[model samples]
Target: MSSARTVHLLRHGATVRPGLLLGHVAVAVTPQGIADCIRVAAGATFTQVVSSDLSRAAECAAALGAPVRHDARWRELDFGAWDGRDPTTLPSDALAAFWRDPDQAPPPDGERWSALIARVTAALADLPDATLVVTHGGALRAALASACGFDARQVWAFDLPCAAMVTLRIWPDSAQIVGLRT
Candidate 1:
């Protein structure tokens, strides 16, 4: 492993609705989400705060009381046609197929998981020594998965709770998972 750079990856606060993909949609944080994120990051000493342009992520970053850099690259996976659809309503085979090999699957006209991985990799590569990134759950998982060479199955296993903070160590050759939260 190379010299590690500390990264505090914060998942955005929860939105008003649940069980919806909400990909590329701009949804604000629920009241409870704002409170929870403020509580979690209140004591953190961060160098800088970066967030997705979406309102939910931006609101969470705002609670940190630091200037935030909003970037579209950190947005969640685009679900495209499935953005507003209920997962339960999709064909059973559809989910199974995607889960089996997410890299090859694109959600209708949405972005592929591989593309997400590549974009996140580039973002991390360009990050400074230490930073606090507030983004979507899927975005966090993509970073972790790429750093560790985790496959699609293992990537989905990463459970990022709303307003949770995960510490990641990024290196030139590899990355390490430092910590996680509820």
Candidate 2:
């Protein structure tokens, strides 16, 4: 067995609702968005492709030219009542607090920061070497936390634009970013 494993977590491209919290809200990805993702992964080979069951992520996984394993565990954090709502429209203080400490100020009735970390940690336990996970930005950040032990706020500092890809080399107790493509 290899001493380390590599996982590439690719965030799905821009969706229909560009600025809304998109958890469990199925949104269509523009054709150019898909092309952007494909271009990012162009010529990058992986042993396996897994994707969030959401169509936005699944479609990009399919475009990567591999049979995909759809796993809901990779789904984005449920925004609860805030799902599909623009942050600009919400109470600014509440939105700011959620960004500062999501666990403390989670979206009303939404999934907690702990919940997201838990599910993503479990998913990391079941992966093959050189795997590609086509997922959402929230899920991508969760993967960084799950594999590297970065806290919620620290993970948020990562700039995971749509179609951004983070490649990590994961060991038993730690992970290193091997590459990144935005």
Candidate 3:
């Protein structure tokens, strides 16, 4: 028999501040969005459930009706001075540079992309055999980057929308994405 494990990474749903750049901000999730998240996780079973400590992600995780481990390692990449600001208000050139290589051009004082990968990698390492993680989009992306062996730019190809769930089957040395649903 194989010793592979399954990990379900789910991004939190819409927040009260929908369009703003939210990084490490404890913004609340909209009621409807919470309902949507609950619907998405309905019928799912896992031996362990985890979530980011941020309110948005934590609320979604709570709605799943499980005793969850709220971890800061799964928090979104902190946007620093740009946190909770309208992305449109930021300098286009800087934003473009961040998109090209976030670690090199991260928001002023924000958490670097590489740093996020490190924390998320550690968080994933501690997971049990069957786990459901309610986290932010960036955290999910960071996990994907590690699982798929994709670089910063290449990882953006994944379409992780609000309330989306991606299931990864992992072994000691490798991982495979078995399913994804939004």
The top-ranked prediction according to lDDT is 3
> 43-129 in candidate 2: lDDT tens per residue?
456889999999999988888878999999999999999999988899999999999888889999899888988888889878888
Candidate 1 global lDDT: 0.81
Model 2 residue 9 lDDT score: 88
- Stretches of candidate 3 off by over 4 Å are none
lDDT of 1 by residue, 113-142 (tens): 989888888887777767888888788888
Give the TM-score of each candidate. Answer: 0.93, 0.96, 0.96
lDDT of 2: 0.88
Residue-pair clashes per prediction, in order, are 0, 0, 0
Report how far off residue 31 is in candidate 1 (Å).
1.2
The positional error of residue 99 in candidate 3, measured at the CA in angstroms, is 0.7
What tens-digit string does per-residue lDDT give for candidate 3 at 124-154?
9888888999999899999998877779987
Which candidate would rank higher by lDDT, 2 or 3? 3
